[model samples]
Structure formats: C-alpha cells, structure tokens
Target: MPTALVTGAAGFIGYHVCEQLISNGYDVVGLDAMTDYYEVSLKEARHARLESEKFTFIKGYVEERDLLMGLFETHKFDLVIHLAAQAGVRYSIDNPRSYLESNIGGTFELLEAARAYPPRHMLLASTSSAYGANTVMPYVENVRADHQMSFYAATKKATEAMAHSYAHLYDLPITMFRFFTVYGPWGRPDMALFKFTKAILEGGSIDVYNNGDMSRDFTYIGDLVSALIRLIDVLPERGSAPAGETDSLSPVAPFRVLNIGNSSPTLLMDFISAIELATERKATCNMMPMQAGDVPATWADATLLTQLVGEIPHTKVPEGVAKFVNWYRDYYKC
Candidate 1:
C-alpha cells in the first residue's frame, strides 16, 4: 500500500481527506497538534473515528522540525498533504504569534523535511482569504493577490510562495489549493454554518457580519475532499502548462495554485435562510458591520480546477446546509 503523510489530520478537512485516502487503500500517517483552536475534544473525536491499522494518528505540532524530519525519514511517504495551519482571521489579529508559529513556521519545517525525502506530490491547503483585497469576482488562480486583509490570509499566501520556492529548488511537485468558505458535516464551530445552526436552534440571534451583505462560495467538505483527491494525481510539471489565462503554473517550478470552490457565490442571508430551512426555524439576525480582516465577499473561478480535476464543488447551499444541520442535530443532540 502507498504511504501518505497528512498533517492536520484531525482538522475538519484533514479528517475527511484522511478517511477518503484510507478508503482508497492507502496507509495514512496522520499528525495533528490537537490544539484548543476550536475544541480539542472535537479534534480527538475526528481522530477517534479514523483509528485503524491503516491509519496511525500522532499528536504533535508540525513546526517541530525534529518530529517532521523523523517522520519524513521513516515514512518516505508517497504523498504529503499539508493542512495543519492556524485558521481563523479574527483570531490572527489577537494572536499573530500563533499564526507565525503554525502557518509560517510549520510550513517551513514541512518543506525542509520534504527536501530531505521528497514525495511524488505534496498538496497543501490554502484559503480563499488569500485573495484578500482583490475586488474581482470569480477569483482565478492566476490573479495577482498582493493585499491581504488579515494576518491569517497573509500567512497562507506566504506558504504558497514558500512551497513554490521549495518546489523550484528541490523539484518538489506541489499543488497549493485555496479553499473558499468550506462547510459541511463535522465542520469547525468558528465557521458561520456551525455557529448559525447552534444559535438559531438555541433561539439566539446569529451575528450577521457586513449587515448580511457579504457572500461566499461555500464549498462542502465532501466535494472539497473529492476534488482534492483528484488533484493528487494531476502532478504539477515544469513547462507543461498549456498557454491559458487561467493556468497558475509557475514558469520556473513544478508548482501551481488552484482554487477549490463552488463557482456560485451565495449571499450571507441566503446561507442563513438555508440553515433556517434545515432547522425548521427562523434565525434572528443581529446586524453587524464587517469585522476587521474580513471581506465583503469571496467568489472562486474554478476553471483551472475543472480543467485539472474534471470536477468542482457543486453542492447547493440549501442541500449542503441541510446535511450539516442533520449532522449538527445528531452530534450536538439539539
């Protein structure tokens, strides 16, 4: 069986990816810090579900160079998926140190380790927030995204550059996929869907950021996982990019960035309505201005993703929200 090293395997996306890899007959070594970023128990629970002979879970920080080097030397993994990073935009403002440590420092350690024992392909998770202040709708991967609205996004963008340099110097085939507002079953509590469901179900008002005028290309977890797995085979090759405007392939390296998202952007209030429909209850919205490090909207241009993977996140808001609500009700007993 092929061996894969999945960092942040306890996270929402990490857990699903690891589960899918195992189902596909891969022996996965999962590593996570299990920090209290959201809830450690939830992370533990996700890891618990993956316990098996094929999946080995290790609890540790990815920034620890010793741990990563030891694992890379031992496993010599066929594939490496980097998903462990300090998430959340608002949290980055209060605690920039954690972002530096996890997002920036962690990526550095991973790249160094990969340099020693290179994998066939290394897929790293980025965010749509990396688009930052770009007002252009349907963000294409080739777009120049320089102005980041948050420290969280800036660090993610830095990782893209970091990975590219490593890929260029060491011939590390890397795909940095940026995710737009990913949500689904077993989602993080800090996200809108989870928080909105919990509040609306408990008869509390949900905070409507940007006065509910914002929008997002909310990609479901299942769809995201499917598309991501597909990319593992679409290895980036130097000088193989077709001359297209949507191609984000680097001219100097076997590296590229792809936006993984539902191309359809849904309004924030519409998303809340989906939640209300799922819960069979109306949500009281507490209108709030846009928070620091937040954008009014995010939309993805997944042409490159489709061209490479032949699939995109197509789950509608209502359908995805209903799936999440069912999971929430079952998980939380609400």
Candidate 2:
C-alpha cells in the first residue's frame, strides 16, 4: 500500500481525506494538534470514528521541526498532505501570531522535511480567502492575488509563495488547492453551517453577517475530498502554459494552484434558509454588519480543477445542509 502522511488528520477536511485514502487501500499516518480553537471532544470524536489498523494517529503540532523530521525519517511517505493550519479570518485579526506559527512556520517545517525525504507529490491546503480583496467574480488561479483583506489570508498567500520557492529550488512536485467555504457533516464549529445549526436547534438567534447580503461558494466536504483524491494523481510538470488554458502551472517549477469549489455562489440568506428548512425551525436573525477580515462574497473559477480532475463539485446547498443538520442532531442528540 502507498504510505501517505496527512497533517491536521483530525480536522474536518483532514479526517474525511484520511478516511477516503484508507478506504482506497492507502496506509495513512494522521497528525493533529487537537487544539482548543473549538471543542476538543468534537475533534476527538471525529478521530475516534476513523479507528483502523491502516490509520495511525499522532498528536502534535506540525510546527515542531524535530517531530516532523522524525516522522519523515521513519516513514517514507509517498504523498504528503498538509492540511493543518490556524483557520478562521476573524481569529487571525486578534491572534496573528498563531497564524504565523502554524500556517507559515509549520509549512516551512514540512517543506524542510520533504526536502530530506522527498515525497512523490505534496499537496497543501490553501483558502479562497487568499483571493482577498479581489472584486472579480469566480476567482481564478492565474490572477494575481496581491491584496489580502485579512492577516489569515496574507499568511496563506505567503505559504503559497514559500511553497513555490521550495518547489522551484528542490524540484518538488507540489499542488496547492484553494478551498472555498467548505461545509458538511463533521464541519468546524467556527464555520457558518455549524454555528447556525446549533443556534437554530437551541432556539437561539443566528448572526447573519453583512445583513445576510453576503455570498459564498460553499463546497461540500464529500465533493472537496473527491476532488482532492483525483488531484493526487494529476501532478504538474514544469512547462509552458497550455494553449487557451489558464493553467496556474509554474514555468520554473513543478507547482500549480487550483480552486476547489462549487463554482456557484449562494446568498447568505439562502444558506440560512436551507438550515432553517433542514431543522424545521425558524431562526431569529441578528443581522449584523460584516465582521473585520471578512469579504462580502467569494466564488471560484474551478476550470483548472475540472481540467485536471475531470469533475467539479456538484453538491447543492439544500441537500448538503440537510445532511449536516441530520448529522448534528444525531451526533449531539439535539
């Protein structure tokens, strides 16, 4: 079996990716810090569900160079998926240091380890927030994202640059995926879907940001994981751009970046309505102004993702929201 090392293995997306890999007969090693950014029990519960002989769990921060180096030395990982990061746009505004430590420093540590024990391919998780203040609809990969609205996005963009340099200098095959608003079962508590579900179930009001005027290309977890698995085999090579294709392939390095999203921006109000309908409860809305480090909208141009993976995420909001609501009720017994 091919050996794969997945960082943030206990995270919402990471857990799902590990499950997918294990089910496909990969020997997976999962690393998670189990940080209290949310409920530790929730993460523990997700990890507990993946208990299997093929899956090995490690508890530690990826920024720890010694620990990462040791793991790389011990296991010859064929693929490395870096998914652990300090996530959340608003949280980065208050605690910029955590983003620096985890997003930047941790990625540096991973690059160094990969340099020593070179993997066949390295996939890093980036956020659509990296598109920052771009007003362009359906953000594409080839466009220059120089203006970041949040410290979190800035750090994620910095990692892209850092990864590019490593790929150029070491000739490492790297693919960085810019993820849109990912939501589904086992989603993060800080995310909109989770918070809204909890509030509606408990007769509490949901904070509708931007007065419910915002929009997002909410990609479901299953679709995102499927895209990721497909991308693992589509490694980039140093070459000129393909004719009439906006491939983000680097000319000097075997590196590429693609957006993995639903490509359909849904209004925030519609999203809330989906949740309300799923739970069969009316939400008391606290219409609030847009928070700091937040954009009013985000949509992805997933052309490159389709070109490479041969498919795009097609989960509609209503169906995805219903699934999340059912899982939340069953998991928490609400």
**CA lDDT of each prediction against the hidden true structure:** 0.93, 0.93
What TM-score fits each model? 0.99, 0.98
The deviation in Å at residue 211 for candidate 2 is: 1.0
**On residues 1-334, what C-alpha lDDT tens digit does candidate 1 reach at each position?**
9999999999999999999999999999999989998988898889999999999988899998689999999999999999999999999999999999999999999999999999999999899999999998889899899999999999999999999999999999999999999999989999989999999999998889888899989998899999988888999899785536779999999999988898999999888888988999999999998899999999998888888867655998899999999999998888
In terms of lDDT, the poorest run of 10 residues in model 1 is 237-246
32-65 per-residue lDDT for model 2 (tens digits): 9999999999999999988999999999999986
